[model samples]
Target: MTNKDKSHLCWTIAFSVGLLFSGRAAQATLPIELEVAMEPGSSLTAPQEWTRILGKMNLSRVRLRSIRSTDQPSVTHVQVGKSTRYRVLAILSHRDELILPKKHFRMQDRRKLQTYFEQLPNETQRNASPRGRFDLTEKQFRRLFTELSQPVSFATEGKISSEVLHQLQKKLTLPVVQTPRSSVLLELSLRGELQGLSTGTALAIVLRQHGLMLQPEITRDNSMQLTLATYDSQGDAWPVGWKPEKSIRLIAPQMFEQLTLEATNITFAEVLSQLKPRLKVPIVLDHWILTQREIVPDQISVKLARRKTFLKGALNRLASQARLATEIRIDELGQPFIWVTQFGKDSPRATQ
Candidate 1:
């Protein structure tokens, strides 16, 4: 007979003998003794059974080893050297021919093994589900796709944001632009097809991947408009192509009041330098127009008597004296800034 068969027979006889003596134990707490004969290539079934029984009692590996050595033959004789009972049982349950490494018996590895065991039933159920089947009909797929507005399913590999925007614009027949030149570029590949999703939903996902978001707005003519812009945690502060309205109602009256300036025979440049910080608002100089006109800011002289006036009135008076025009333009964030240009020139439009 094989060595394993012989070991199994020995273990059976030892366990039978131990059962008879177990009834006459001196104390209930004392462990039962089994006189076992072990050899190389011994049957692993006995160890697996003992592991299950001992595990139920929450015995540590060291305690289990002490019990086996004291009450039975040395486990080393069976050619399974120093393997924990739990590890032995795990290997036997999986029918793995190769022995697990010693490091695999660590607490982290044990928890992973437990997790695998727990997930097995759910995995089996998923495998048997209809959705997991590979035999989906073309008609069924078409019907599934149609149920959700026939979403434009697309997959790209390592494409930049501009290319993606172009593709989205063409597919949806809408204009898309990256407002700020510093917007993030997307460089990723999608593995699986997005099934049964809407066009808006798919677009949102793609934009979110690149740190962007889609904002919807209604125009004065009651038409829907879509814009893709950088996301702000505070709110939708920046929409790519939209401009805020410039109206007196939108500006606080206090912003234009309680401003004082008095400069005689001083350069307009010096007066403006002082007024900018006092107003605490952004001022954009039309350098392109000034360059074209060959106007020197310091050469232009200004004379203003000491008086308190509204910011707008002061700025207009200063501009008229300097032969320049001023316009108030609001940005995407609904914040206003001053734009200075030559007189009788069309104001520059905000870029999308």
Candidate 2:
């Protein structure tokens, strides 16, 4: 049998974290016993790929041990009375894994978005005022475009402030200018919901990828939510032909469900539809791994686990806020595998 086949026999008895080298049939003995201890706080060398494989396996606890090679041991065997247990056996070794270290991680400013939007010329004001009159020059248009480049930030604790709304009003009132080439110039302003450079920029990048020009604004009615209202596009509402510049970006569940797209790509639409299913679901951070454990038909046991972790901003926050626990089982083969399950005090229930 292969090395993996022999390991399964050891696994049936207890957790084995190391390898077991087979000896000649003549050297085999009865009732071998092994002792194990852990090297605390060890980390996994390859976390994501490994963990993804582990999660599908559902087990109660995982055991890990450390050792040198199993071929020969300085301390061979120990005896108690008439019985002797192998004092030097193979051990399982585990690498430590990372988790969310704290409560929350957020970026972008909602109050700022509110202020930006409040300043914009609303439909009512525009209706009351005359159109097609201009005092703004090309330099002023460039200034407005430059203003669009500021990143958005979000709040973690409370609602956005009214002061942010006032600021938006001021920024939105800049003079609308007509270009020398006669291409219509409408000042576009967007108020951001989430805060932080990555989140804000991701959203902005996505909007830009979609071919729509946006400026930031802030409002307070919604907390932990994304609200997109086309405040102004030129002198009109959001126009056609504009597409978001970035796709495949990260979003919190709150916003994930709220956001919508007008795209025709079937695969992309499928992904969005999955994100917005009516059922309230766990926000599977982009790098979520699923794993499973089972007995194979062959006597040679195989235990497999999958792992996935991403370095995106939202994931960084999740890692900062999470703690991971893993359970594992060994089979006839010396292969060590994990059963990965996640638990949280505030964890959302799994959805259908």
Top TM-score: which candidate number? Answer: 1
Worst 10 residues of 2 by lDDT: 98-107
- Give the per-residue lDDT digits (tens) of candidate 1, residues 1-352: 8766765665664455445444444432212122222323534454444333333322222122212322322212122365212222222212212122221232224555444433433333333335411222344333322332334445533455455545555655334445663244444432222223344444544554455566643333323345666654443322211134545436534446766767788887777787877555555555435655676677999887889988777877887687787766543334455656674423234432
**Over the full model, what C-alpha lDDT does candidate 2 score relative to the true structure?**
0.27
CA displacement after TM-score superposition, residue 315 of candidate 2 (Å): 20
**lDDT of model 1, residue 126:** 38
Highest lDDT: give the candidate number. Answer: 1
Q: What is the lDDT of residue 121 in candidate 1?
A: 31
Q: Write the per-residue lDDT of candidate 2 for residues 142-233, one digit (tens) a residue.
A: 44334433433334212332233223324333322223221211122322222332222223222322223233222232111122322223
TM-score of each: 0.31, 0.18
